[model samples]
Target: MKIPKIIHQIWSGIDGPLPQEFRSLGETWKRDYPDWEYRLWDNKKMVEFVKNEYPEYWFVYQKYPFNVQRWDAIRYLILEKIGGMYVDFDYESLQPMCEILENKTCCFSLEKEVGSNLFKVFNNAMMMSTPNHPFMQKIVKFVFSRTTLIPQYTNKNLTIFNTTGPYALIRLYETLTTEEKEDVYLIPAQFVSPFTGLEAEEVRLGVVNQKLDDCLDNAYAVHYYVSNWVKTNN
Candidate 1:
């Protein structure tokens, strides 16, 4: 079956209006794929939906930091429940998604490596899946298991990352058997994130004067790494 042409984004009401950069990104997608559905979920709506559908996780969802941390949980839940593409607001579409979504049950992007520790880490910033794909189901199960073992009041950054962010997703992906791995499509970093978190600063400053590399010639989208800037500035 063809993957549904639905794109999802989250912007809690507290975040205020969408910035011009994000607005431009949304416009780009709309212009490129007018037939696709663009669905935006705010904090209130997301909370209500989770409460009704996954009551076991509602407490953990409510307890997570209201910032981007909660999105770690929200993205998986939304995708598992409805089955579609979830793109971070920080990303821009360089090409249409029709080619990427064609005949794929699920797909994830590789993070640009920062060091030996982060090499080959898969990023959840942009993910596409059919509803209730096993990988997503495992992610939800991972969240529930972690929440039980770790106290929610802990405010440590690393703790939050491990619990709901790429750290957790990476850990789960590693445990899958070879046969299970066949179900997932992994996009190389060059396609989804040609720039690492460190290089994002250079992109922001306009210091890197170069054209897109051949590796990105067929990239479907580019994650601008705005979240890295937000965390750094904080």
Candidate 2:
């Protein structure tokens, strides 16, 4: 079955409107898929909607120290309630989303490794799913379970990654049965995020030179790793 042609993005109003850097990228997706619906959710609207519809999560959601965690939570909620595609604001589209969603009930991006590791990690930065897909429901439950038993951590990085980033998603995904995994598709890093977090700085500096074109050549969308900017500015 074809996934619904809806695109969702979340941003805190505190940041003002979508940054100019990402505007053309977003517009490109719209131009390529005129029939698709684009939905942008800001912080205030996200909180109000979550409070009314998912009251169980409101208490924990409000307690998150970083806006990124809240943003992560709401993306799962939105995708669970209304099946569609969720792309990070920092991503630039290189192709129509329909081609990616075709013949898939759910999809996730496999993140590029920043260091030596035996296992692959999937990113939550971009996801597509049909409404009420089991994978999304599982994520909602996982988030609630973590929030209810908040743990003490040494640093912000660990807390953030464990709470709402790719690490948490990877942990939950591992628990799924073989049958449940069949409906999900994992797109390679080359197709969504060719750069690892460590290499993201080069993209920001525009120092990649010729390698830039090669990295993006096979990607449907390139994730600019803008979250790295958040850490630096803070």
Candidate 3:
């Protein structure tokens, strides 16, 4: 089945107004993929989504150390239930995702590691799936199983990556059976993400980045790395 032409992005606004800078970035997605359905989510809608559609995860969702963690988890749940592309608000589109996602049942982008703290090869920032795909199903189960802190838990400092983000996805992905793995595509950087975190920041700060300008020449999408996750949570 082809990935549906629905796009999902979330901004908590819990932090106040959605930043002015990201508005133009979001416009790129709309411009590149015409006629696709877009769903923008906020803090309250996200909370209600879990309570209504995933009542079982209600307590776990509320107890998450940071709202960003919930942001990471809900994307998987949404994709699995309805099947669509869940792109981060910081992500910009150079072209429609239709071609890259045309043949895959589920897909993830290859992340360029820029720091020691970034511990995963894949980024959930740009993901696509068909409804009820096994890989997404597994992610839902994975998120729940590791959603809370236990005595054996590490990263007590609190990180979005390890707790419920891409690192958790990478961990579960490694255990997938050969058959299940076949249906999930790990797309290389050139197509979805080509810049390192440092480069993304450089571009955002208005520094001239010729290499990334070139990457945009080839990639269908670029994640601008507008970080919403706090390094530590209370």
Residue 218, model 1: Cα distance from true site in angstroms: 2.9
Mind sharing the TM-score for model 3? 0.89
lDDT for each residue of candidate 1 in 34-124, tens digit (9 for 90 to 100) = 8889898988888888889999887777665445566678889999999888988778777786765678898898876766754458778
- Model 1 lDDT, full chain set: 0.76
Residue 168 lDDT in model 2?
Answer: 86
lDDT of 1 at 101: 60
Which ten residues in a row are the worst by lDDT in model 3?
149-158
Could you give candidate 3's per-residue lDDT for residues 72-123 as a string of tens digits? 8899988998888888878888877676677888999987655664544887
The positional error of residue 132 in candidate 2, measured at the CA in angstroms, is: 0.8
Task: Write down the lDDT of every candidate, Cα atoms only.
Answer: 0.76, 0.79, 0.79
- Judging by TM-score against the true structure, name the best candidate: 2
Error of 3 at 191 (Å): 1.1
Compute the lDDT of residue 220 as modeled in candidate 2: 77
Winner on lDDT (1 vs 3)? 3
Per-residue C-alpha lDDT of model 2 across residues 119-174, encoded as one tens digit per residue: 76887889998989999999888876645247667667777678777888888788
Q: Name the lDDT value of residue 234 in candidate 3.
A: 33
